[model samples]
Target: MGCQCSKFWVCCWDSEQKGLVVEPPSVENEENSEADDLPAFHEYTIDQLRMATSGFAAENIVSEHGEKAPNVVYKGKLENQRRIAVKRFNKSAWPDARQFLEEARSVGQLRNHRLANLLGCCSEGDERLLVAEFMPNDTLAKHLFHWETQPMKWAMRLRVALYLAQALEYCTSKGRALYHDLNAYRIVFDDDGDPRLSCFGMMKNSRDGKSYSTNLAFTPPEYLRTGRVTPESVMYSFGTLLLDLLSGKHIPPSHALDLIRDRNIQMLTDSCLEGQFSSDDGTELVRLASRCLQYEPRERPNPKSLVAALIPLQKETEVPSHVLMGMPQSGATLPLSPLGEACLRMDLTAIHEILEKLGYKDDEGATTELSFQMWTNQMQETLNSKKKGDVAFRHKDFRAAIECYTQFIDVGTMVSPTVFARRSLCYLMSDMPQEALNDAVQAQVISPIWHIASYLQAVALSALGRENESEVTLKEGSVLEEKKNKTA
Candidate 1:
């Protein structure tokens, strides 16, 4: 019987013989010995995988189908405190041990920033596990399909398209162009809020040399007929992803290509992108998607061409992925100057004495008791405005953030240096350097010793062409930071 799987992908299963079967190596796989020269990967033990996974505890399981599936994924932390996602495959997935190691070694040799890096593999006894860098934030499917708070913005969706293309370009450049079953669930957001394609998806099941994503419907039209995946098939899957991004919903690749040919781009575009992108941008993207979904595999654009096309569509350089995705920055703290940290831990008792002795007045001598009816009423309003500002800030609506923060600051019911710093940042983003500097100075005045305020002042001054003052302010901030660290 002929095996449809290419050697670059994986071995095909001999169901009648009840074992994995291998076809002759392709020209690509014949040269796969190059992986031998690559850096060595850790051959983790079954015991180690068990320990990291808390003996395969139920809570650690991350796979949607649980243990009933042929493969299960678990989230765990290594002894070195590095987090990881472990995929444990069924015994029947790979009947031969060396073939399993060879496949693992080849995949483990792959390294790219856009890839959810494969760290190690365990193939001891009946246990087979693959470990990858853990993504704290969830998958693209969650952000796009089942968005909770807000849908991904147009800029972000465009960025995701570019990022996915770059990832595929990198893999193809590295001679690992056989990335299978590419889809939304295969892309996970990392700790830095960047989307990365999971490398585990690159590993073939060995059962059939087939795509591993549970939803095989995402496969290209040719793959269904040929039962083989090529680089061109991956591009077809990529077109489906483009449709997912544009429409904010899954559309069959066949249907999507028809929509493209009919020039029904408006129906293909998500309503959320109503005013976000120009018609030219939409038309260009639709054209690209159509090219990717060409009926003939040879007609589709390669990964490099896709990358070239997407480079022009990207906007908002240096903006973090999470910001545009409308999700919280993953565990990243606000960038605070040394003074900001000091203010956060400032001795309230000492501050109170310093204020009384140094003639600092609270809200023009209005008592600081929150229980008072007058103060309580003002406090409620202040809290509400600050909350609104935070929501706006998370949404990257900087102009609205400034307005809400300004309202909170104007009330003066509470003394929050952070509020002033936030407004200063919004001002900077809105290209109002003078207002930014004013807010930064006000923040410093409110919390006399905060380093972030001085740092922000340096930024504002530099932006305003006051180089000399900016340098001085920067040095002052450095000194404050040094003092705080020494005190700590």
Candidate 2:
């Protein structure tokens, strides 16, 4: 395989023999050449990363453990208006900058729907950041064991198992099979409510002095004998994940196997999943898990075989997200904000600055339990006010729309960039430039990447006769709009 100067052959697997075989994917990847046409991995500057993640704010951290852990991950958004997860490695993780770049590139090249798609990397001096698509829905662990509402449905669990196995299958096919730190926490729900293996797992290669966190009880049997992990070890981990899916708890692999041996599948299954799966479904999955947890690593089935075993049990491709968690589909009842519709017109950088000035960032960092509770309590009511504002604004009644949006904002706990932007537009129409500017800034503070917020600010500035400032705002909005369009 080659990419101009980055010419290096990948170590492919012998699918027929299940052995190591060195084969260049250059020829084989010809049909899939579009994969290579993905956006180039940019070497982001540290400042860009800092702004994207709100300077690594404590609230941005999404990892289950240790903020001061050797490596930490934060959720952020790009100037391009993309939601991203930024993994920041401590200086000691890779003392050598060149080595870090090589490893980052190696892992970043592997892309698939089943895995988090790596967008780019940042290697400036000691700071190393790997940016990948952010999953809005939480991990399998949260959905299964520690759900906020209720446990995952049986259909969703079956789908998660199959999707994860297939993700592993895709990685193995790409000739990068040694996935580290594989667990339920590593499998996240994507935008479509599908399970996706985190691309961060790909970084778990044979690097020296690197150790991953996992419960000691679930260590793969082969790794106990040898310090190294082979492809089969990954299958063993996948088995653990299957157990997590079925049991909804971290059961020791040995204990789980014992329970399976007794055919106590009922004891092994999650009580929440009771009456959802048939005996045949339970048996098929348990049998597959048993094979995966084989003591002899060589006897363990490969990822491809695991995919085959799980596919037969797969559910419908597009299950509603609300159904998975026993929630109802409520989007139509509550509009997603007109600002979301005018997203392509805002200045992203100016919005970020507005947020930074207002002591807020994005959801992961800026939002808190109290704020969320307030939103949850008054969401429908807030929608009613915004809806009234929308109706008035549509009828060219700027005064009425401003009064409606003001009431929604005066609640002080509710957040809606659209309400702020709409109010600012009304203020401008009423020849109230100062009020328009204040509301425009508030809109940006709540939703930093929204383009329309900045556009409104520019209109307000020009009305106030701040020509130079208005020109700068217009240029920033133009740049943000161009980026949005290109990505679109």
Candidate 3:
């Protein structure tokens, strides 16, 4: 007699002589259809499911059992001694059973390293179930923002970014589906710390006429105005995801739907990662994100280009700024100014006369150690060279000044800001604005808050016809100096 059960199963039994015997379960004769056309799935009755979930015990539930997408996820052991996650889908809204089946089919066909694999599904009578590969690490969103968990490290963040980019490329190219929703919540990590893109319930085929729903914060601005899902739109969402990952903060609950609407991006960044991230790299990322959020869809970069732009950033933890210019050796001094020479050479015999003339002490102790003397000699030489260079500069003898400055620069003596600043000025006087700009930029990089150096840079930049950039440089220099003063 056939077993009175709707579930399909393979029967197994222990024989008296043999250890065990495998046989097919008998079922009532019904009109047969082409089984080859349908996807194969092992069926389980409600009673079998109950046994697997330990009588539907509350403890077996891995996630909350409520009315929502992915309603209930239960970690249970099947009768065959295999562990799996049983996702119970809410059938109240899915009035058409065939639509649910098609969704499952679409998900099953997607095979990607960065994406979660759909194992199988069950659609018998009113009960709907989806079985997927169990991921123990759960979602990226929880780990990133949860108060109890440790924050994601820099390396992990980069890895997540690379994995996400690969997954998006995969979906758009091979699967030919638009992952309309690519958010932190949809990313899950495996035991090995590899990220997997999940939650394709909102995915749509590229060929389908149906459009994706607009979640303004995560949606591209163009799509928000006109509901359409393109590959560029997916890239926009990915960019936002990158921001959230780096920030390590979730969208605020109050304005969750309109999180991306805000123009002041600094407010959206995570306070924890404030000083940890590189300013230059952060600026680049923010710039990319802004482009992604552009109102015109065509203005955004394609996925391939986006990935290419992020390549360099992914390898390095932080972009290094040129902080120190060429360091001259210590004890170096520039040539004495014309005023110094005239006063020293005039040398009045009377102490009173010397004091009145130069306003200086006549009996000041001079450095006498041999090493000190040698250092003084080097300083005198450098000063003489600088004086010669200055004379050349005054006569518009740029080549002579360049040669003198080059030799003085090679002496390994400490060149003060004024000296380098003057050398840069000579370069400017020679109509070599590019070279002058280079020197001034180097000086600024070495000491961004140096007022004289910054001013020189502004002048050089103006000469180069980059007035806007010059203004920005001046503003940055002012800000840097102010910040230093405040800190001091």
Question: Root-mean-square deviation of each candidate, in angstroms?
Answer: 18.3, 14.1, 30.1
Top TM-score prediction, candidate number: 2
By how many angstroms RMSD does model 1 differ from the true structure?
Answer: 18.3
lDDT of 1 by residue, 1-488 (tens): 12121321121111212221232222122234422433347888987777666567665677675444568888865544356899988877876778888888888877666778788898887777888888877899998999988889888888889878878877887788987788898899886778889988888855568674545566777887988889998898888888899899998877776665555555677877777876556655666676677788887778777777777788886898878766655543444443433333332233223322423222332224444654576677888898998778666688999999889878776766677777777787788989988887766655544566667777777778777666556655665666656777
In order of appearance, the predictions have TM-scores of 0.60, 0.65, 0.48
Alpha carbon lDDT of each predicted model:
0.70, 0.68, 0.54
As a whole number from 0 to 100, the lDDT of residue 67 in candidate 1 is 42
lDDT of 2 by residue, 248-316 (tens): 889999999887555555567787776777655665666677777889898788877776667668765
Backbone clashes in model 3, listed as residue pairs: 332-414, 334-383, 335-383
Best by lDDT: 1
* Candidate 3 CA-lDDT value: 0.54
Residue 410 Cα positional deviation in candidate 2, in Å, after optimal superposition: 29
Worst 10 residues of 1 by lDDT: 7-16
Comparing 2 and 3 on lDDT, the stronger one: 2
Local error of candidate 1 at 423, Å? 48
What digit string (tens of lDDT, one per residue) describes model 3 on residues 1-488? Answer: 12211111111011112221132232211214311232334445655665555555565576645533335667654533344567675555444558767876676665566666565666678777766555556677776777353566555666677667666665556555466566776787654556778644443322233344324455666665767767777776776776777567655322322333443334556665645556445545555555565556676665555556566667433421111101122222233233222222322122113222432121122112233543587778876887787677556576787778777667755443344555676677677878876665544433434544555565566677777656544443444445545677
